[model samples]
Target: MRTLVVVRHSKAEQSGTPDFERHLAERGHGDAADAGRWLATQGIGPDAALVSSSVRTVETWTDIAEAAGWDLEADFDRGLYSAGPETALDLVRLTPPETTTLVVVGHNPTMASLAQMLDDGEGDPEVAGRMNEDGFPTSAVAVFAFDGEWADLDMGTATLVAFHVGRG
Candidate 1:
């Protein structure tokens, strides 16, 4: 009955600078904030937040936290900066079972792929409906429910609850 929310970091600005250091554009800040607000409407206050250490990811989470007003404390991990979906899954699996809800704010194609990869509800209409909604845009949040404890979550074991692609 626990929830896992995966938030693909907000749209970021491209610069001549290296990828890890790029900052969020002005529009991205607002987009990230919009996502946070939307998540609030959906009742998404994560008990724990696992975030990437990249600058853009950090900035996006900051704006999201401000908008959500959850004042949540997050654990920033450098491994998440360039980690793949499997790596991310490992982090989630290791989360303390006491955490009822969790959020992972990071990058994608891994995010999108992970959603599809971990979807468990094959014939359920709502799961398919949510999957059909839209791409995981900047600040997009995907919510899913796992059949087992977080410690035992596996590929294709999650059922999509809601897919939010926020617009600013």
Candidate 2:
């Protein structure tokens, strides 16, 4: 089976910084690190990660990487900067076949939309209900499982196996 993890960038403070340069807030760092630790406990580790090049996204990944002790390098893509759900799915579909676990770190509502759209509503009713109500909050991780290669991933093909939202 293949696993896909989609993570929305952690909380970012809006100041004089531009959208692309905005760094993660203190809460974001804590939340992201907690998420990493949680993933580690669940024995979930990504073989590869596709991350947005934006500052907040990069910072969030760095925190997660440190806490998870993952040495893999991330493929930071410019196309993921502000892309929508379709673009996010396309990027996931293009992942190499050898990577059994792939993680994507980017912004929302694209991340949330992709999670909600790809979910067949057959995994966890509680998670799905919470997602429907609150949407994908920052630092939320949505995990999907499938029985095929990355190239064949289709809408609603993967089953949502787990979902988590980290908080400071």
Candidate 3:
């Protein structure tokens, strides 16, 4: 089975920061670290990650990697900077079938929407319900499980296995 983890970029300074250069806040840092630990405990160490090229997204992935004790090299894509759910989905499809696990660290509402769109509502009902109701908050993690290769992945073909909101 293949697994996908979608993570929204953490909170960032709202003012005086450019859209592309915004850095995470102190709370964001702590929340990201906690999320990383959560991923480790959940046994979701991704083999590879596709991250946005924005400062905040890269920082978030770095913190997650450090906290999880993972040695992953992220593919920072400029197309993911302000991409939509469809764009993100296309990227997922491009992943090599040999990659059993993948993670995408990006911004919302694209990341959040992609998580919801990919979920077939066939895994944990509670997690799916929470995701539908609360939406994908910053630093949130959405875990999906798929039975086929990445090339065969499509909308509503994967199951939502877990959802986690980073807490500072």
What are the models' TM-scores? 0.92, 0.96, 0.97
Over 1-168, each residue of candidate 2 has an lDDT whose tens digit, in order, gives: 999988999999878988999999999999999888877877888999999999999999999888988888999998899899998899998999999999899999899988988887778888777767778899998888888989888788888888888775
Q: Candidate 3, residues 1-168: lDDT per residue as tens digits?
A: 999999999988787868999999999999999899999999987888999999999999999999999998999999998789998999988998778899999999899889978999789788988888889999999999999988778899999998999886
The per-prediction CA RMSD against the true structure, in angstroms, equals 1.7, 1.0, 0.8
Please provide the root mean square deviation of candidate 3 (C-alpha atoms, Å): 0.8
lDDT of each: 0.84, 0.89, 0.91
Error of 2 at 141 (Å): 0.6
User: Which lDDT value does model 2 have at 150?
Assistant: 90
Candidate 2 worst ten-residue window by lDDT:
126-135
Q: What is the lDDT of residue 7 in candidate 2?
A: 94
Runs in model 1 lying further than 4 Å from the true structure: 122-133
What TM-score, to 2 decimals, does candidate 3 have? 0.97
Ranking by lDDT: 3, 2, 1
Candidates 2 and 3 compared: the better one by TM-score is 3
Predict model 1's lDDT versus the native.
0.84
Best by TM-score: 3
Better of 1 and 2 by lDDT: 2
Model 1 lDDT at residue 71: 87
Off by over 4 Å in 2: none
